[model samples]
Target chain A: MDIATVNALTYEDFVNVLGNVVEKCPLIAAAVWSGRPFLTLTALEAAIREFIDALPESGKEGVLRCHPDLAGRDLQSGTLTRESREEQAGAGMDALNSADASRMARLNQEYKERFGFPFVICARMNDKANILRQLSERCQNERAVERARGIEEVKKICRLRLEALVLTDAANKL
Target chain B: MDIATVNALTYEDFVNVLGNVVEKCPLIAAAVWSGRPFLTLTALEAAIREFIDALPESGKEGVLRCHPDLAGRDLQSGTLTRESREEQAGAGMDALNSADASRMARLNQEYKERFGFPFVICARMNDKANILRQLSERCQNERAVERARGIEEVKKICRLRLEALVLTDAANKL
Candidate 1:
């Protein structure tokens, strides 16, 4: 949790901690492992750069598969782990209300029908209103755009997860 | 380009035309109305829920903005037209090598020193190498977390121009 504590981790330790995150998301693992000679920070960064570049076509579907459908009242029951659900739900259920919940469910169905996947986004940081607005607006995007957007969203989610996982010291060093 | 033509644009057009990707330094923006949305569709998506619940800290920043540092690299020079040299440089420099370029210089320094924007991700259906690599490695971020992840990146850039000025459909819809 502390920067000093995280910084103290050996490169192997660092990799081990990150391994959990990578395992949960293959795109992330691919990005981390892509390219060779992890000699310097810059080189490591280059590997990341390469991964980001390649994500759209190659990694989009893989990342999408990691997400779960966002429907039903039991927000806790979806693909999100308990921690993720708690973090995302926060005090928003009351805010979601009945109409919002129904809309989310309907949109969820339409989204799946069109794109063959649940509507996924990084809800950890957003509030109820913004999430609702985005869901309604994004539903309007053509199936293609929304599909591609879905992959990008997954990458952003991973980026956030990565950010949270990074030690404060390593973060500062960067 | 006509709306129909633009709307018909495939993944490439979506990124090149709608997303306004840069030719060099995929992350750098030459001017206003250039560069990708800060939050990927997926990231924005997740944030949408949080936004609905509480309006995440940077939800406002997710709007969009013009790059100040990209002023000098304008393709046409002097004129600051919507389609001017500066603007073109910001939007069209996606392919430029990041190794040695003033844009990258300003982007890296200003982005890191200012608020730690680890270069936004757009995945405009182009070469996935750069984006994939960035996504993987950027996971190890802290400061870059807020600026680089989710809708924050888009919000930072959106301030430069109004929605009406860039996205025709969004403008009309709004």
Candidate 2:
């Protein structure tokens, strides 16, 4: 809907509308609820990003863990939120063949084993191959680097998903 | 890189090695390729009642369009395999929100419009949310009664790409 419409939502309504905007991180929306009457999508996104930016390291990891693995079990079992499902599919994670799927599953396992969290990438910016390749390449990085990279990817995901939640017509006026 | 070594691949090598098995499609892997050569995953998945059997028409829609929007700019951008970027991303169709990136752009537009060539479901299964949701919801149709349902989704996307040359892996496996 329009920003005007968004602006008119009650605090609870606003939270309900945007609670899933950032995959499993409703608190982001919850935290941003106090800063309502956002003039533009960017303003709203920035507020949420800022909250995430200031999050404690553990908190940040918690946010990271909130994301399901790319094409991981959640997609098949229907456990993922609507936003997460769309993001992974946009990246074409739904159509893998046997050989490629096995590799991704293994990569997901490895990335989790190494970093203690699932590999997180902005699937919108990537196709399945690229996501797999990056997951492979990133698995070699030091933990700190990968953590930072995951967050960066999360930022990209936020921007993409935020644009989704904010509606393009509303964004066009900006 | 050959099929023989697929099982022995380390997480890194595995990702680099079998990375493109499905290229644009991620579900084929999640559905078929499991940790123990795939049978275990699908069986265990079956036991959970998660196996995608005879997807509802909407579910079929998700399965069919699990491909990229053929002609998505990413193909021309040289970031993805030519076929996949198009089938998954659909470039020239600018209307889709970055969030809608999971659905093939032009194909999605066309499929919704025509219900034709673009909606071919590969018949494999996975539980990815976007795929399942699309599959479940899009499967609802009056198409069987009206042939028109099959043709609309394909026509909307002839220009951005009409390539029909890429060989399916089934041939490669053969």
Candidate 3:
């Protein structure tokens, strides 16, 4: 849909379409609806990023916590939200060999223990090998730095989601 | 917390505290935060209901779809969000017999098949037996009727959650 179509949407329709753009945090989309008549897809995205960036540390962690663990149980039981399923599959998370899956599980557990939230990267932007390496490397970053890094990744995921749903090229101009 | 304390929370704090009041649908809490400085707990809950009741049929379904299945894998694996885990346990869902657990699984699957959303009842307001009975009976409801019933159950769940988090007796005045 065009930016006008997106801007014209009622709150419910806007939320229904863009709600899951930020993992399980439909709250962001719901909050952003009040800022409608977004001049372009980039403005819409900036609104989303601003909301996330303005949250307190605890709220930011809550947003990260809403994400499912990479290659975790929800993926196994076929119960992941559609966006997550597609994104995970795109990065070969759905096809991990037994060894890779087990290693992923171990790393994920350790990551959560340290960070109090899931290790989030934009899966569509990276493949499995790179994801594993990043997961391993990021696990050692200072907690505050890692939290900021995770939020940045969330923005990347959000931009891609917005591109797919609304106008594609507008965000690039920003 | 008292009404003043509840009302005084910043949007981030308000959402952090009450975000899961409607199961996984934090969008309701996020949207409700805009209406803050509530006069009383009753008004706070009314705001939540207003946001929900205003949703179109599909949005209502989207709210219901956010619920985890009763005694489903989330419970078995101990991965339920804190609010859901406590609510389910308060009704003794944590201790279902093997036979009952299997029956619940089957019924939940069938209910989803019929309604396109999980069977939802206020588990804190009903024991496992009543939940099962309601699930079985509601499974036969016309799709539209069942959807409404599920939303009412969500409201009941929301109220109980609000009572636990904010003032308790003020909502009874409504």
How well is each residue in B62-108 modelled by candidate 2, as lDDT tens digits?
22333333334444466654434434433233334465445555434
Tell me, by lDDT, which candidate is best: 3
Interface RMSD of each: 13.2, 13.6, 9.1
| TM-score, predicted candidate 1 vs. hidden true structure | 0.39
User: Which residue runs of candidate 1 sit more than 4 Å off their true CA positions?
Assistant: A1-16, A19-23, A34-49, A55-58, A71-74, A91-95, A168-174, B1-174
Considering lDDT, which of the candidate structures 1 and 3 is the better prediction for this target? 3
TM-score of every model versus the real structure? 0.39, 0.48, 0.56
DockQ for the candidates, in order: 0.02, 0.02, 0.07
- The CAPRI class of candidate 1 is incorrect
Ranking by TM-score: 3, 2, 1
| DockQ result, candidate 3 | 0.07
Clashes of each: 74, 48, 0
Please name the candidate that would achieve the greatest DockQ relative to the true structure.
3
CA-lDDT, candidates in order:
0.42, 0.53, 0.81
Which runs in model 3 stand beyond 4 Å of their true positions? A168-174, B1-19, B22-159, B162-174
Mind giving the per-residue lDDT tens digits that candidate 3 earns over A89-156? 99999999999999999999888778766799999999999999999999999989988998899999
